[model samples]
Target: MSQDKTILVVGTYDTKDDELNYMSNCIRGQGGQVLSMDVSVLGDPTAPTDYSKHVVAEEGGSSIEAAIDSGDENTAMQIMAHGASMLALRLYREGKIDGVVVLGGTMGTDLALDVCQALPLGVPKYVVSTVSFSQLLPPERLAADIQMILWAGGLYGLNSVCKSSLSQAAGAVLGAARAVEKPKGDRPLIGMTSFGKTILRYMITLKPALEERGFEVAVFHATGMGGRAFESLAAEGSFACAMDFATQEVGNHIFGGLSAGADRLTNAGATATPQIVAPACYDLVDLVGWKPVPEQMGDKPAHDHNRLLKAVVLSASERRDVALAHAEKLSGAKGPTTFIMPKGGCNEWDRPGADLHDAAGLAAFVSAIEDAMPDNVDYVPLDCHINDAQFCETVLSIFDGWLENGVVKA
Candidate 1:
């Protein structure tokens, strides 16, 4: 059930007619507006379509179907994603859509998430899938907002037990849509990520710099979704600017870790707007538990940054690959964009007594970035270390310039 409050039901009408209708009826029976959008990947249905989306209700609102005839697979996929997003957005604007419910095995879940993910974060997006029971990412990777994954083996067509399951799912999403209270604020949102080493830089300098400039910052820890989040918010228009301060996700993303959350590290940076970036945590990847540093890592070197945080020192080649990926993403950075580097240390842990500190690794990271990056960006090197007072000041000054005067502060 939707943890928040109003319920919206979504599904593919062509294949799952009996099931989608059953869930819609259940939601309506409980006093929720069943905003059912028919996604016809097969052929057009008779349901009352939303706009030019080729959807219509057959026996009035009781049965829904697709309106289009046979089409190419890729074309159909694009249509489903577009139509799903449109339906959700329309409902969202009218204040009717609260929580969204989606059903199907693979294509069904994919189409549903297309719409569900379009909903806001606090809003619940629930999907009952068959293929997803094995690994959640295969399907969930498509979801943008908060999602609930339930593996019902395979709920392809309608049946007695399947109907019962869909009914309950519908009940949940409806309850949530009606109750969630959207937070109200006028703060200009900016998304950021920080780690223990550089949390001070965010709290001490960057946050204030933006807040003083009238931007409200939303900071996420540089765990895994760190860089991804900062950039995603920028894409959703949630943030005025994204300060990917602690780009720790890059290590997890490139090195194979469960934390990167399935997508590219900086998918959002591929879009417009200038984003400030640095090798915040280009040090290495952390393993689950140091049980002899695994096998392939082989006598290379390691750093156990406590009992939990185990980082494998990245090799020069790996560092170059990461730098290339990062550069490719930021090559799309428009307006006033700058890649800042600190000659000293990128993180506090890189200084004196920190366990994971590796000067050679940090240097390799810098060299990789410098070499792999295109000539389009303005790369600056600060003489002081990352946490040094002057370096922090320089970052803030540059940020102010981007926000106001236009390029290179002080």
Candidate 2:
């Protein structure tokens, strides 16, 4: 392993020997030292196994080949994934590697993502898979399981695409190595979640407000990847606080909505960075269009923006469950936190008279907060709705509290 370098070629030599070897050569040829570590599931390895998936497999309960010998690729894949994550995380802890580059076929991408997710944020990571382009592989499982782990943008397994993606990924890793020498300042990063509705509000108002108060905020657009990316950074210790102002996606997660589950919903908040987490827009579910709106929701309350992408008012039962769950999740925050309720409504169309507004649901939402909230946190109700300027200001004020007192010892 090259301690002096950054890019590390990580893959299973059992299958991707040729591709990984090529990746290693390209990385070194471009002025980046490459360390080839085997995440091989085939027992002993020829390449340096910095943190073997075999070890993780052994430790995490199952071996891949053992599972395969029983004629179960599905089981083997599951075991391999769990083991890969453990192996990558071990390497990350020891600091023997910096960046990771992987090459594989269908099984390769699946196994590769397992390793990617385990490594921390900002590390250069790449995966070149032959099965990447095919619809044969389940995109949702692949996405939910592996996307966050790739330190670099991913490449499809197609030959042409791999060639393009690998070259860029290799060069990017080298650049990351060259750039790491410049130490960053001490200002803590803050994670912010918003949507198109609030993006403008944040840009014109909140963004400057946060920066002026000394917080370096990273905003996520409440979309699946965007939300997941923020949580990923948070788990990697990237943010000191968060303003989860747009949580409408919870309904999207529960429904089969096209958005995303955006894993680790409560992760950053629970880490305790003086989180000002709220039920922001927990009152409604995002629908691609009004056509899919369930029969119970009635012809789109008044703010049905367009026939295609309409916001459906959540049911009284759905609102109660989600609000209860949201409050329960927000309570997981490890740092000082607050949950604010705006008396009027949550989003643009959620005010007192909007068609999408479900005052019954709103009351149930706050009631759940009051009844189910964890004792470790504080729950405060405001005299405004989500779109109200006061609610925005209060959210910022809580972050300010963290900016003053949220340095956890390293």
lDDT of each: 0.62, 0.63
Question: Where does candidate 2 stray beyond 4 Å?
Answer: 1-5, 42-96, 130-169, 175-185, 197-204, 258-264, 287-311, 352-355, 358-361, 396-410
Tens digits of per-residue lDDT for model 1, 1-410: 33233566666666766777777788878876666666654554456533223432231221223323323554455566666676676677787766677776666666665666676666767886765444444422444344454645335566676666677777767766665565454775666666764323644677777678777777776555444445445566565556666666666766664265544434445444556666666666666553557676756566666776676766777777777777776776654457778877777666756765767766777888888676767788877667778776877777777767643222
Tens-place lDDT digits, model 2, residues 93-184: 77766667666666767777667767666565666665554544432333322322222233322265455656766666666666654315
Point out where model 1 deviates above 4 Å: 1-6, 13-22, 40-79, 94-96, 120-124, 131-140, 153-168, 181-185, 196-201, 258-271, 286-295, 298-310, 371-373, 384-391, 406-410
What's the lDDT for residue 326 in model 2?
71
lDDT of 1: 0.62
Clashes of 2: 9
